[model samples]
Structures are given as structure tokens and as C-alpha cells.
Target: MKILDKLPYFIVAAFAWVAIVSSCANQGMPTGGPRDSIPPVLMSTQPEYKALNFSGEEVQLTFNEFIIPDAISEKLVISPPLESRPSILTKSKTLIIRFNEELKDSSTYSLDFKNSVVDNNERNELEGLRFSFSTGDVHDSLRVAGKIINGFNLEPEEESLVMLHKNLHDSAVYTLLPNYIAKTDKEGNFLISNIAPGEYHLFSINDLNNDLRYNEGAEKIAFADTLIVPDAEFHAEADTLTQGLDSMLIEGHTHFSPEPFFMRNFTENIYEQYVKKAERETKYKSTFVFNETVIDSFGIRPLNAETKDWYILEPNEEFDSLTVWIADTTLAANDTIPVEMSYFQLDSLEQFYLQTDTVELVFTEKKEESRRGRRGRNEDDEEEEGPEPVPQFNWTTNLSSSNFELNNDIVLTAPQPLAGIDTSAMLLYLKQDTLQTPLNFNFTKDTAAWRTYRIAYNWEPETSYTLVIDSAACINIYGITSKALESSFKTRAEDYYGSINLDLNNVPGDVLVQLLENADQEEVIREIKTDEDGTVVFDFLAPDKYKVKVIYDRNGNGKWDPGSYQDKFQPELVSYINEVIKVRSNWEWKHVWDLTPDPTFIKNIRDKELEEQQRKEAEEDARRESEQGTNQRQQQNNMFGPGGGISPGSLRPSGR
Candidate 1:
């Protein structure tokens, strides 16, 4: 009986322990006192930073906390870079690096670990870690700072390799590695410190093959036309635009010459022109494609058929490709057709020659449907066949609805290549109170479409109209004529459209302003060229979101062009207004775009804006993590059992 009395107390104590264990299990890993936001600090170095007469092949860095060398091979940049990558290892809080190549004598070597080392637990990144040592008695200490910019869009090019060449020859970029090098950070900003003061040429290479040298046609490169001499600023006045910049000191009151260099990044685009692909996809069509735009004579002809006009030639806007539509019925129905293609082919010596070849094009089919009927029925089926489709010409129109948009044209398209259209048999009528009135319209061929024709008419707003095309009005190359076709539609009112006017202040010469469909700026809805007064207007725009893009047509070619590195010409810069230009019904929006700032000024401000944007993103991420922690605690405290009571399942503790 005494033992039984103690059992009641034992059961009560067990229940109390169970409740505590359940609470802990649901809480997840403990908060552990906020987080380790502080990055690892460098406490000591092997031979002391900036030490002279450095003779060892190994370098070591000890930090205040444990560290991780995350992707050190890729992130560590050493100038006068080594021919081969070094081996990097971490032990506890120390990072050790062993060089594989010999170091240059009487030269200063600097290693920049741009945000590669991080604390062990929280992965806090240590930013802008640098170390310098010299093989001789003296160490170089001058610095140069600059940025790499995309030539076309004027955006910063991030993580590009900035190189300084002492040779200064044009061929040095292709032959030798740079004397001093540094990599751009996430913001496309780089600083090469501990450089010996001397005249140096600046260049940036994307380095796809990791050779540290520029490879034409395989890498993107930027060069500074003028050589840069790194010097210190003693008492120079700062520019007004740089008032918001952080004050950086090299020595005492010393700055990086107070003038940042800007490098224009571009591709040479000297890819050799060659046929990329050629194939016949259907019974009636074949396509041929080339790598680049064909600036010379390019032609294709059907060799199997004897008829002169065997196919209709259709060239893309770029003129680098052709779509051949077989017009001859015999050639179109052939199982295999031979065709001859002639085009300019580039040789290894960069010379073009007219080359011709004849090849056979054969159509293919999937295995399952190889012997099946048109409707996927087995060929051996003994079912009665239905009547064949009528031999009428297949054609379609854009009139899908009763209401018509004001900006659209009445288009008619046929499946096969069209031979001609009998305009005399076409009729357009104005329908009022069931009374038809003949209206004058133009049947014009749309240059941008294939096998298509457009009907041009000055349609009255809110008025219904009927269009009639008699039989045989449209004839295809196969001698088939279209059947009768009639459609009725009402034009939209003027109140459904909007207008936009732009006042371009301090505009550059020969500017092409384009209004886009959205902020993506992929499709241009309307475009206008600014006159000498720098004013352009776009009238009768439909209600939609829009954006504006301006291209500086420097060559007056009516389009934007990329730079030619060999010609020493920079690409024309493009500017964009990113605000959502919303067009509402019957509203006219006017905007004054100030183009006073040059392209360089625009690029510099854009870099700062991106920096501020990244800062806000970092803060938002921290807030979200904090809220998640609080939510987890609340979930632990409010957790309920499956059936509303602390039953066996809910009483499950940590281990048992």
C-alpha cells in the first residue's frame, strides 16, 4: 500500500516532465541570443600586411571567429596573377593559401578577397579583404578606382575583370597577362590598391576561358583609349556631383586622384557568317538560316522541278534567312525535293566567296502515325469513307468580332502563296437602316505580310460597314479561287483612345523616341522622331500601360548600333523612362523629359540607385526573418492535440 501511494506521486512527476519536453520539441532550434551578424575580423597575419622582402610561398590569415573559404579559387584575385590557381584551405579560424607559381622579384603582389570569407555559423560575409606584400624591400601603395559599363544600355557590368597593362601595346591584351588586376564587386565597382605609381593602360575582360587575357570572338572586352597614371590628390576640389560619396583615405588626406575612370564594355561581333541550319519542315515549305546578316547576294532555287517559278521566296527582315514556299504543285507533292542554295561563305582568312550546293529535303513522320489515316485511324479499318472536303480556296480574315478597333486594318490571308487578287469584284458598303451604300476603298498589299492583302478605308466612328468579296476574287498559285466572303463590323468611337506628348529638353541630335507597350519595353506601339524643337506627339493611342525609350541615333541610320572595338567607336547609348505611363480613355498625358545629363552622368547615378535598391532589399530580408522567428514561437505555444486533449500523441516527448 505504501508503494502504491508513491506510484501516484511518480505518475504526477512523469506528466510534468512530459509537458516540458513537448514544449521544447515544438519550439525548434533555440534563438541562441539574436544572431551572429558580426563578420569575422582579421586578428593576425603570417608575415604582417604590407611586409617587405616577402620570400615564402605560403600565406596565412587568422580571424577572430571560425571562417569558411567559400569558392576561394573563383573569388580570390591576385595581381600580378599566377599562371595556375593556388590551393586554399581552412582550419578552425585560420585560412592558409599555397601558391603554385613563383612570384616576381621587385614587385608588389596584392590579393583581394572580395566577399569570399564568411563566419562559420551565420555565414556573415567579410567585405573588401585585402593583403599586400613585396618581394623586394619596398611595397607599392598607390590606388586606382573605376567602373565597367555596358555600352548599349549604359548599365554597370558586374564582376568584370579590370586589368592594368604596363606594356601599353595594342597586341599586349592578346599576348600577355596584365601586371595588376582586380575584380568588380556586386555593384560593378573596383579598386586596385598597392599599385606602383606609373603610366598604365586600363582594360576589362569578361575572361570566359579564364586566361586573364582578351580573346577576340570568345570574350567581351573594354579598353581605355588614354593611359591612366595613378596619383594622389593633395588639395584638389571635389566635384559637386560627388558630394554624397563616402570619403575614402589612402594615406593621410590622400584620395584616388579624385577622378574615376569609366570603361565602355562591348563585343567585337566579328563572328564568321555561316549556315546555321537548313531543313524542310513540311510538304510545301523549307527554311534556311545563317549565323549573321547576309550583306551580299543570297538565293535558293528548286532543282527537282523544271518550271521557272517553282517557289515563292520570303526573306526575314534581317535578310539572314529565307523561307521557300513551293508554288509548283508537282514539286510540293514530291516525297523528296532537291534544292540549290548559294550564299557568301567566310574562310579562315576572313574572305567571302560565293558557294553553292544542292541537297535533298525529305519530310518525316512519327512512328505511330506512319501508316495511319489522316484522322488517326488504322489503314486496315473496313469503315465506310465520308465525302471529301470541298475544293474551295482556304482563306481567313481579321474580323473576329462585331466591333472593330480604330488602329487595325481589315486583313485577308490565304494558306497558299497568292498569285493575284481581282479588286474589281471586291465591294465595301456602309450599312445604315438596312440600306447599303457603296464606299470607295483601296485594296493594297501589306509589305510586312505573306499571302496577305489589306483593305484601307477611312472608317467613320460608331458606323456599321459590310465588306463583300465575290467568288474568284482571290486566286492562289495553285489556280484555286476563293468562295464568297462577307463580314460586318462597327468602328470604335474616338473617346476610346488617348494621346501622349513629350517635351524633350536638351535633346541630342537625331533622336528616335519609341512608345512601348509596357515597362518591359519589348514591343514598340508607336514611334516618332523629334524635330529641331525637341518635341514629339503620339496621337490616338489605345488605353494601356506604356513606357518611353530614346535612342541616340548618332549615325542617323534610324536605329541603335553597337560599337566596333577595332574602329575605336563606342556604341550609341540608350535611355529609358521607366515610369508606368498609363493611358486612360480620352486622356492626354504630357511629360517633360530632361536630357541635360550626358550618358556618363546617367550611368553614374544609375549605379548609386542600384546600390540603394540593394540596401533596401537586405533590410527587408532581415525583417522577414525576425517575423518568422516570432511566428515559430507562437506556433509552439498554441499547438493543440489531434483530438483537443493532451492524449498519447500530444504527450510524445523528445526521445521516448
Candidate 2:
């Protein structure tokens, strides 16, 4: 063995050292220890928990370990809640609570440390720890519990305030704070304990601003119709976990479980009347929007009515909106006209009272300037001015096809609000075989929509119809004339429409089924009411994807009512058949809806359908991959030729 042999051994030693160092570096930094799970434990307290005849101003709690006050001022709840929140402080392992108000006589007060006391280092919460004291001789121990959910959608409402009130007045919920309040948990469960048994009205409010009182616009509220009396019996039992039989044992008390109360919180939009805004949509047409519904048609006139008569008013059916037409042609483009409008509006008390508002009407954009071509001297002398271009207006319709159905109306909308209609210039013709016969039709303005007109005729199926409107058939507020337009449409065969047969189970007294485009959009294509047999047939439905929503009409009113808060009523229950029913042309879709089912049962059906669809897609993808692999193998065989290919006697042909 010479120097060369020694070099090989040295290289092997160097590699081994590098591998060991690399492996050691991969271990990274060391973790300290297992996580801390034990929360802070109470060692002692001044005037200890459940102290009787307590009149102290400050409570000092000492813990076994160092504790931190994590948002104790906000998280610490004093029940019945104090007039003012108390100040919380920490000194080493001790927590101090200083009450700013005097405690009531003979009343029990509980300071709930709802996870506010945490270990200093690990931040483990001391959950559900409470300190209770009676200012008088003994404590008044009674409990009430309930749950809260949204009125329309049955989703749990968290952090809502459930309160009790002794006063039976209907206005008490609006004017005064509650006697005892408890916030709802994440599951909408609430418990109010240590209450003196008495007759009390129960209500729940969102209390969004934390003002304690119910606010009409900012809060949602729910109330129970019947007065609740906390009379459930409770007894004490020996503590098994804390104390042994040989040790001095204290008893732990448990209350009897009562029928839990359920409340549906709802918000009402009280009638408040005010104009939202007035905007000029076109050159001579302006629209007005109101916060509340209007009772009558509004009057619009120029401020100087004696000099200007350009404005005319049209009120929509809902009375919440209206359009104003300015017919004065002398008004220049891009100009705004000031006018005063008078209308009957709802006041604070919901009475229709007359009110007036001033609005500014703006005109449309100015017309474009025309360019002139080069002209001879004679042509220039003759003045190359052409007749003023006709003010052009276009009309469009909401009809999907030229052939309108007997059930559908032909609605046409104008570019500007029309002041006058020339019905004689509009004609309808019925095409029977090869002969086109003239027919009479009536035109009426649709009061529900602005600048819309409906043409009605005795339409018959299996017949083609053509509608023709000559130029100047309608005159706008600016005196603009509509262009001549003609359209032809044919009616569809009766068999082309789809039908739906629904057999409902566990149906409420009255059921209202709404056929919607989808679950998310909620666009109702049609709605029908069914009888006790829970049988409903919806005919003449278009071929599309749809969902069925069933409303349990609890009040037998034939409609779903969102419950009134002050009236202490629960809203009507509603559920949807989550299965997406695809109705093809000339097809009939039938479904059975079970009303008395679990809330998530419909969602499960939808999820199962989705999973099945995914499974089919996966199989199709695998088939495609297999075909592609076969095609590649065929190409390889062709490239390699017969010599390189498998022998016919030994190989099997591919199967299709």
C-alpha cells in the first residue's frame, strides 16, 4: 500500500463526513416541548363564589398559575348586565373586577368569565368560569333556555340577544331595555340562569349597535306570543368528580329540561316616504323613485306654469316610480328644465299626505355636426342646406318570437316616453294558409312599466301573424316619430310544450309551488297552488332546467307571510326540491316531494347526483385514454412493418 492507495481511503473518509454533516443539518431547529392544554385554575377569591349577603365593590380572584386578561372588559359578561361595564385589571396571577354601579337588593349577579382568563404563556382559556353573589340573604335560582334562527332561511343566528321583560306592554320592546339578557351561542342555543321566577315576555333582537333597545331600521327581532313562567323543578345531587365519599362533599344542582323555545327573528321595512332621486333618462323623459309606495298619480308642472307647459306626468302601477314627459320641442338639446311635482306620499304614521318636490329634467346629447363636400360657386350661392333630418326613434318588443301565443302579450317599448299614439297606423294580419287576412287589434299603455305599450288581439294557435307599424305610428315627448317596422312570427305546436306532474307528500294544508329557473337565481317561471291530495299539473312549460320550491302555507292564506316581530308570529316554512329537473321538448317530468324531511336531505340528493355525474365523466375519460393508447400502438405497428410486428399465429387481434 502506497500513497495512491491511501488517497482512496482519504476520499472515502471525506465523503462519509460530508454525508453525516448533511444529515445532521437536515434535522433543523429543536422544538421546546409538548403543548400546554391545562387552563388557569382558581386558587382563592375574595368573598368566594356563590357568596351570600355580598355588598363588595371589588372582587379579586387568585389563580394557581400566572394568568393574562385577554379582552376581559369586553368578553366578561355581568348578568343581569350592569348599567355600565366594569373595569378589569390583572396583577400577577390575580384578576380584579371593579363595579361602577351599586348592586340591586335581593338580586343575584353573575360575572361570567367566558374564556377571558387565559394562562400567561400558553394562552389556554378558563372557559365557562363564573362568579355569583347575592346582595340579600339567599340566591334566586331559576333558568330558561331557547334557540334562535332566521325567519326566511332556517339558518342559526349567533350572538343575538334573547331577553326577558316583565312589562306586558307591546311598546316595551321598542322603548326599554330587557330585564335579563343572554347571547346566543354558535348553534343558536342560549341559557339564562339564576333568574327569580316570574311571568315574563320573551324576545330576541340582533341589537346590532349594542344599544340594548330594539331599533326599527338597524335591528331584527322575534317575540313569543305567550308569557313564559320559569317554573321547571331542579334538585341538587352529590358531586362525584370533585369530592369523594370520605372527603367533605358538596352537592351540585341540575335543572329539569323543559321544552326548548324556538324563535324566528325577522326584520320589517316600515313605510318611510321620501324621494330617492330624479334623473332624466332621455332628452324629454325623467323618472322618479320613492322610498315608499305612492297612492296616486303625481302632477308635474313647470315652476312658471303660465309660461311653460312642456311637462306631462305618468304614474306606474306600483306607485313607487313614475315618468315625466317634456313635450316642448322649442327646448334646445343638452338643456335642463326645472319643474315642480306634487304627489300623495306616505308619512311617518303611514298616512297618505300630499307632498311636493322640485326636479330638474335633463336633455339628451347634442346632434353631430355634418361635414360639407367641395361645391362650385353656383352651388355655394344656391345654399347647400338640406331639409332638417327627421328626429329618429326606434321601437322594440319583448316578444321572444314573431308568432305570439294566446297567453302571451305583445309588448313594445319606445326610445322615449310617448305623448300620443296613432293606433290607425298599426295593423295586424293573420296568415291563414296562403291568404293574409287583416285583423283588428287594440293598443293600450302598460301602466306597470314606463314607455311600454301592449297590443292585444284574438290570437289563435296554428296560425301565423304579422304586425306592421307605419312611420309616425307614435309620437314621443320631443315629437320624434318612430320608423316603420314589420315582424312575422308563427305559433308553436301544442305538443312542443313540456308538462310537470308533482305528487307532494306530507303537504301542509295549503301548498304553493314555484317553478324557478334554478335554485340560486330563483327566477320564477311559473307558480301553482295544489289541494290536499298534493297533486299539481303545470302545463305549457318551456324546455329548460328548473327547480321546485314548496311553501307550507301555515296560515292557509295561499301565500307565504314573513312573520311580524311585534305580533309574535313565526314565518311560513319553505323548502325546495333540490333535484334539477330537465324538461325536454314534448316531455313530461314527474317528481314526488316529501315535506316532512330533514333540512339537509335535499342537499344530499343533489350531492349524490353530482357524484354520479363525476363518476360517469371519469369512465368516459378512461375510455378516451384507452382508445388513444390503442391508436398509438397501431401507428407503431405500421411504422415497424410486418418483420418487426408480432406473428399472426401467436398474437391476438385487437377488439373493437
Candidate 3:
């Protein structure tokens, strides 16, 4: 009876052991094989690579492993560009390219992957894969390679479109698309392959609207005057292989050894003339603003012949702008002034033509309007019109030269016209211990600028002085009284400021030298045009680190012109000296720079900057890749086996 009762317990123990073993078998993960490191390999093509007389509607490429396309449309470059971009599709491990436009007869086509294909799981990229096909019997195996640089700064022009023109006419680039095109890399390097062996014109443009046309004044352009022939020598060489299936022997490829062509980019600014606006502040003054400075070939005539004598025309140096001063004081205050202006204006075709415009000038607030009442207004109704507003104004003293150059005088400007001043209420004193010495000074209005006044007194270095003006000391044209004012200042010490003596070598006349503050060469502290012998001196500069920039003025204009494409002008060259000069108190810093063009020196500077940028990007990519690998490994270890094992099926051989 005891043995039979223990039988149920034994059966229960056996069932419990079986359940525990089954659970353990299902819980553990399988150890995976080595992590995938090789990129997808191109096994075969439907119409073999470099296929001659190809007539297929679609091209197919079979890879050893499944691939995921990343920005394939953007990275793929098609030579002898199609009217419509082709469509790309993937089915398992095969990549399909469907033509959207008819292929040109007797033309060679090159499709470049530019490393857009990568393995699906590990995302390892395949580099430098290309396919070539010909619609006729033979293929053009030549290439044109070059570098593009900014004409002004000599910096690398990356992402610029380099084009080849078969028309060979200068005007053709403005209207037609290029025959073949390639984009410059970060290092300003570009190579267009499978070009026919013939003379071809080369040009580069930013292609802002992606139209491939040179839109005047809207895009930058770089052109090569001489035609190019793609007949350079090419040699075959074996490519270095990586680990895994990539280590297998591959066919050698031919590489072209072409002399690098250098190009400079520039933009043209064509002049457009038009009267932007015209302003009339008083009956005596009229200001005409042109799109640009106009110095001649423009006229303003009064509608009434008798008033013509009053017009005094004066144009600024720019020649695009002008101001008219009327000397006639007998004109009525509220008169409707009619005037006719004739000038050369730019038409839609950018051609200059004589155009006339009639304008009725309006002056809302005139000095005479406040002095006289309307013709029908009664004197008794003045109270209803409200008491005239008190003529209020602000005054500013031109202390720009207050650091007190010996030749500078204290200049004060008032918004309103000044009539007279009271010298008795004004005092000047030299600040001395207890006994302040009284100094003699003179005050007078400036002849040229009627609203400006000059206060003159002899100044000595390191001396403090004070000027005081009592209230109502000065009177204005509207009989307004002056406000009380007091000013005190001391001359700077002789050793407080420094100087810079620059010796420019090989300067092509009309260059501008500027002393710039800060490390970025901004904030112009002082600037001057080059004198004879290329000598420039800057005095009275505070202690600071300064940089120098020299602008090569090509047109002998005082200002630097960026450039204009329509005018066939290149921007003036700008050269920066490498050193940051430290100016010390009471010290003079002398610098010598050779402005002569040095091709090698300019290239080295640009190359160093490019290398630094590339290094940082490479480091960032490596860091991300390392992190991804670590996270993947950790996840496998936790979910699968301890050694991060994967199922055996995932390690199926990638047949190449």
C-alpha cells in the first residue's frame, strides 16, 4: 500500500523535470556569426558594363547582398544628361534603372553611383561604382578634370556645376543646357568622363534655379577662354581590396592622368539707371535719387519759364544723384511747384534712352508756411487755429575729432536755423589747481553748412579745459532761446596711442589698405588709399590687436566693386596678411607685405582649411559608427546568447 501511494509523487516529479528542461531550451539565445563588414558587391549587369551598341529599355545590376539606396537619385550622375531623370528601383539584390527619355544615337552615357549603395544590415557603402553604355558602336573613353576657385578670395568653389558646351559660342551658355556636366567636390575638384574626343568649351556656374543656364546677374560664373581636348594618357592599375569577399581578385581599371585645369569664378553687376525717388523738403531744395550715381546727361526744368533762373543744379560725385537749390526767395510758400525732368533711363533691353517725367513737387512743412497765414484766414480766427507749436529742436556737438587732433575745432550742429549768439554769457576756462585761468575763444556759424557753429580755442596736450554757456545765450531764427550747457574734457597723453607704418610691396596702384579690429578682420578702425610708393600710415590708435586687408582696386575707384558678369569684370583681389599685429602704447608697429600674386601660397592656405574641415567630419562619422556597433552588440548579447549569437540562417553565403 505504501509503494502504490508514492507512485503519484514520482509521476509528478518526472513531469516537472520535463517541463523545466523544455522551458530552458526555449529561453536561451543562439550565438551569431561575425558581424557583417563587407559592403554589397556588384555581381553582374544585364547588358554588361561598357556595353557597346546597347539598345535596352532598362539596365539591371545584380549585387551579392541586399542593398538599401541612400540618396541614390542625388548621388547618381548621368553623363550626356537625359531630358527627364531616370527612375531607380530595387528588387531583392538587383538594382533596376528605367529610362524616362529616349537615348541619343551615337552618344556615350555614363552612370556613376558615387557610393550611394550600401549593405542593408550593416550599411557598409560601396565606393566608386560606375556603368558605361553606348547607343552606337563605340564609346568615348576620355575625361576632363579641373578645379574651380572664387576669383575674389581664391577659396574653393565647392558644389559648383562644371559644364561642357558643344556649341562653342559665348552666347550659347546663356540659353542652352550643357552637353555634359559634373559637380565640384569640397576640394573644388571635378571630373566629367566619357566625353567625345573633340574641342569643347568649358564653363562653370552656380545654377541657382537648376536650369543650367547662365542667368545674368543672378548667378556666378567661371569660364575658360581656351578650348579643351580630352586626349590625356590613361593607365590601368589594380585597386586595393578589403576583408571578406572583397579580398578576391578583381579586374584592373584604367585611370586617366590629365593635367589639372584651374578656373576662377566671378559675377557681373550691370548698371540699371532709373529715378528711384524725388524729394522736395523746401521750395528752395529738391533731391533726386537715381538707381545709381548720375553725374551728367540729366536736366530739370521749371514748368514756368520765368522761374528757370532760380534753379541751381548740383550733382554729387557719384553722378547718379543730384540736389537742386533754388536761390529765389520771392516764391510763394504754398505754391504747387511743377517741374519736368529729362534723363537717360534703362529700358527692358538694358539700353539707355532719353525719358522725360513731369512731377508736381509738394512741400508739406516749409519755413515760410509758419510765418504766413492762408490768404482767406482772418486774424481773429488765429485762436481757433490753435497756438503755433513751440519750435523744439535738438543740438549735437561734432566731437568726432574730440581725441583732439591739433587742427580740430569744437563744432556744434542745431536742427533749426540760428540767428545770433550772446558772447557775454559764454565762458571758457583752463582747469588749473585753485586758480582757473580764463581763455579767449571765438564762436561763429559755418558758411557752407548754415546750421553748424564752430567754437575755436588753442589746445595743448594733457591740459583740461571747460566751456560753459548760460541759458538763452544763443537765439535762433524762430526766436527760440538756447539751453544751458557745460562741457569739460582733457587732452590725451602723448603716449596714450600707438601708430602703424605699413610698407606695401608690388602694389598695383589704387589699392585700399585698412586697419581692422578683432580677429575676424571686421570693424574698420582706419582706412586709406595707397599713396606714392605704396606707403600708408595710421596714427593715434589705441592699444589692440589689429589685422590688415588690402583691396586691389581694379578700376581705380576709391571703393571696392564686388564684380559684374554682364560687364565682363572680375572682382578686385583681396589679400590678407597672416599676422595679427599688436600695437602697444607709444609704440609704432611696422609691417611689410608683398602684394604680388603667389599661386603656391594661395593654394596652401585653401588646402589647409579644407583638410581641417574634412578631418572633423571623418572623426564625427567614426564616433557615430562606433556607438552604433556597441549598441547592436549589447542588444544581441542580452536577447540572444552571451557571445551575441545570431541565427545560422542570417549568415547565408553572399554569392558573388
- Per lDDT, the best of the predicted structures is 1
Least accurate 10 contiguous residues by lDDT in model 3: 647-656
- Per-candidate total of colliding backbone pairs: 0, 3, 14
Residue-level lDDT of model 2, residues 602-629, one tens digit each, is: 2311534557899999999999999999
For residues 1-656, write the lDDT of model 1, one tens digit per residue. 46666676667668886766676574677876987799999999988999999989989999999887866777999988888899998877899989988889989999898889898898999888898899999898888888887776567788899999999777888899888999987667889888887888888888988888888877788877777898876664555665567963333356666378777688877757778888888877888888887656787776756787777888887888778887777777777888788888778786888878887888754445434465576445635555555576856898854658776789998887877888988888986645666688878887987777898888777778888889888788878789898888898898988888888888768788888776332487777776354668887788887767788888887877776656777767777774567788899989888765355644322234456779999999999999999988766555544553344454333331
On TM-score, who's better, 1 or 2?
1
Q: For each candidate, what is the lDDT?
A: 0.79, 0.74, 0.74
Best by TM-score: 1
Question: Model 1 segments beyond 4 Å from truth?
Answer: 1-30, 236-252, 302-306, 364-387, 396-398, 424-433, 459-471, 483-493, 517-521, 542-544, 594-597, 601-656
